[model samples]
Target: MPLYLQLEARLRHMIDSGQLRRGDVIPAERELASMTGVSRVTVRKAMGKLVQDGLVIQKTGAGTFVSGRFSQPLSELSGFSQDMRARGFTPGSHWLDRQHAMAGPDEAMALGVAPGTRITRLKRIRTADDEPMAIETAIVTARDLPDPSMVQDSLYAAFRARGLVAVRALQRLRAGLATQQEAQWLHLKPHAAILRIERRAFLADGRVLDVTYSTYRGDMYDFVVELTASSTTLS
Candidate 1:
């Protein structure tokens, strides 16, 4: 979590615990600066995030007051498509490329296969509401998923519907500069910041089903996570 977010959580915990009761006027900027022992700018940043999350409301003549929350859980993780559907939003996509071919060096190693092995590959530009958001390229061992043409956009749902069990998965995200092709598809300028997501899909019995690399527009979305202190520690 960002330092500003940590400060936000600290204040939010106070609000949730009734330390700062509802309808109670919060401290002023200078007072919060002294109380929280942080710079006034940091306090403002935290308060702004809380307002954006709808946990607080500010009044010009008065002061900040606690607000109602939507009560999101800490244990929810779903794909973008499923998340939008749950919110009653229509989700759709455009097919970019779908083909089957042999795995190269990196794909072969990640899929736990020998070099020059056959692999099924599917590529698509994922979008919602006509705005292209992400470009997904998935690579799977042909021995596991030979029919790459049948994949639409949701590879996880496809795997489950085909009676394949997806036990667990790992995803890595980092900042990336968009390439020419990626920028064109995502409707962003070249070298724009994007979030690169690389995931490895695994079956129940340790069989690697696929490895997917996706680039998401940084501006339109923010990946939210609920993490505990122990999450940063080794098991």
Candidate 2:
């Protein structure tokens, strides 16, 4: 096997086995070359392969580090708090706005509530490990959330405490450039690409629980879906 190929395989193994974890910085190319007894050209080639494969990222003046792109399964109905926690990140929210107001037509339709009905809207900057990850806006019937102040961090957790856990949800995903406001909150340049998600959650009794719109940084998030074929039956 070629020397570069061997180096690539070793790095790949480290990444796959979690030895070189997400956000973990790899050693300098010269150091790797000396340690592995390979030429600097071989190390460079292996690093290039990893970058092309999206397993690592190289930043000028910052060296190379494992990519922090997180893959979220599209099949689950989960909240940002739960998802971030499952990934070993500290989940937090910075409230942008929280208030009660008359439901707009779009919010009413998505939440299955009549227009002009009072509702609670919560706008937050979702953070993981103290870094802003996404911007989210959630709307629920005022009755479901009597006191917006009660929701300290996770709205879903607050709902569960009130016996209103969402049993299912429908979500839509889109790709777009970040708005100026989003870019500011997420610490990205204006017009940077982002993932937009809109979701409607429902309770066991089929009542719409809430509607949420989320914008995630495209560089740090990826959505994955698993599909399977069903058997065909003939009579």
Candidate 3:
């Protein structure tokens, strides 16, 4: 086996065994080379493979650290804050923009409202354990949420407080490259892979409650869906 592959395997084992943990800084290339008696070039190669595999991340001047990747179950209907808390991570948000405005073409269609209908728009950078995870923009009719300021952290929580909780939602996910602005907000390099999710949430009475658009860091987030075999057998 190549020296680089061996080193990569060793690092993977350490991470899997919890000898290394999320946000734990990896040893410098020179130090790793010295410790393993491998060439610095081989150490670099191994580190590069780990980064490509999303097992580690390199901060320009801060060295590489174990990646804090999270998996979200697609079957559950929950807000980011709820999800993060469930995973034992502190969830927070940095508000980018919050205002009341007329619904645009897309937002109007998604919320099943007229284009000129008043709406409250809430945009923020969502974080897990203080690490930027996603950018979210949520829109709702002003009648439901009169003010964006009412939402301090989780939009769903605010909705529930107002007795407007969404009972069901339809979500669509697609792969895309992050825009420069999105990259900056998510602390990722320009053109990095991102997952765009559009969700339309409905109230119990069948009225659309909210239309939310989110861009999640692809390297740090995974969406899991459970599959079940068909009940009927194919002859």
Q: Which one is best on TM-score?
A: 2
Candidate 2: worst 10 consecutive residues by lDDT?
Answer: 12-21
Cα RMSD for predicted model 2 = 5.2
lDDT of 3: 0.89
Candidate order (lDDT): 3, 2, 1
Residue-level lDDT of model 3, residues 1-235, one tens digit each, is 9999999989976764456768999999999999999999999999999888788999999999999666577888899988777666678999999999999898888999889999999999999778899999999999999978899879989988898878899999999999999999999999999999999899889999999999999988778789887899856
Extract clashing residue pairs from model 2.
Answer: none
- RMSD, model 1, all Cα superposed? 8.9
Worst 10 residues of 1 by lDDT: 68-77
Off by over 4 Å in 2: 1-22, 26-53, 58-64, 233-235
In model 3, which range of ten residues has the least summed lDDT? 12-21
Residue 61 error, candidate 1, Å? 18
| lDDT for each residue of candidate 2 in 1-235, tens digit (9 for 90 to 100) | 9999999988876764446768899999999999999999999999998888677999999999998666678999889988877666789989999999999898888888889999999999999878998999999999999899989878999998998889999999999999898999999999999999999999999999999999999987778788876686544
lDDT of 1 at 150: 60
Query: Clashing residue pairs in candidate 3, if any?
Result: none
Off by over 4 Å in 3: 1-21, 24-66
TM-score preference between candidates 2 and 3, better one = 2
What's the true lDDT of residue 96 in model 1? 71
